[model samples]
Target: MSESFQLRVNDVEYPLSVDQGRNLLGVIRTEIGLTGTKEGCDDCECGACMVLIDGQPVNSCSYLAVQAQGREITTVEGLAEGDELDRLQRNLLEVGGVQCGFCTPGMLMSATALLAEHDDPSDDEIRIGLSGNLCRCTGYARIIEAVRRTADGA
Candidate 1:
């Protein structure tokens, strides 16, 4: 039987009825209409479905909807304030970090989590923090540069 749960997504609370084994990615995309969280490998490898769960980055493709109850879930849609973009988002654009844009959301979520903890993370630390999120385009150099730029306030 399906169960009902509340999810705080992108700073909005949504009461949804989901299947017993529904994953957060599917729920977010299909139910809540948030398409930023892409489903890549669905095995927790690609990190394409990354989202912030209580300020921590997680693979939403493998995370159950029930597990997200009462937690603050942040998606790519939440990174900006109206017309203003987040620092990382702006840096990504300026540094050419986005191509194809499938992995951009996940990359942003992971980088956001890292910045939340370490505003001045080193390049190596940024690399390690974003190791799980993969990008087929841009070669990840630009993405890394974007994160570093955000950290450095550039």
Candidate 2:
């Protein structure tokens, strides 16, 4: 049987009925109609399904949708203010951190959480912050640079 619950995502509340076993990623993409979060390994190996839960990064693929009902979830879509991209988003593009773009959302989410906690992070700190995410297209140098630039207010 499915359970009906509310998920506050991207500052919007969405009431949904889904199977109790449904993952947050599926619910966010299918039920809530937000596709910014991607499903990579689906086993929590890749951070492609990463989203912010109460300002912390989480792998939505392994996290149940029902468990996310009471928390604030921030997806990649939430990072932007309408047509204008967030600073990190613009930096990612400006630094050529995005390649195929499959991993960009998760990367952005993780980096967002990192920057929220650490105003200025070192190279090691940035690496540790984005350790969960795996990117195949960009060697992660540009991605790291983008995060560093964001931290440096550049």
Which candidate number would show the highest TM-score if scored against the true structure? 2
lDDT per residue as tens, model 2, 44-66: 98899999999999999999999
Poorest stretch of ten by lDDT in candidate 2: 10-19
Tens-place lDDT per residue, model 1, 1-154, is 8998899998899999888699999999999999988999999999899999999999999889988999999999999999999899999999889999999999999999999999889889998999999888889999999999888887
Each model's backbone clash number: 0, 0
Q: lDDT for model 2, on a 0 to 1 scale?
A: 0.96
Model 1: residue 53 alpha-carbon error in angstroms:
0.5
Candidate 2, position 112, lDDT:
99
Name the lDDT value of residue 86 in candidate 2. 91
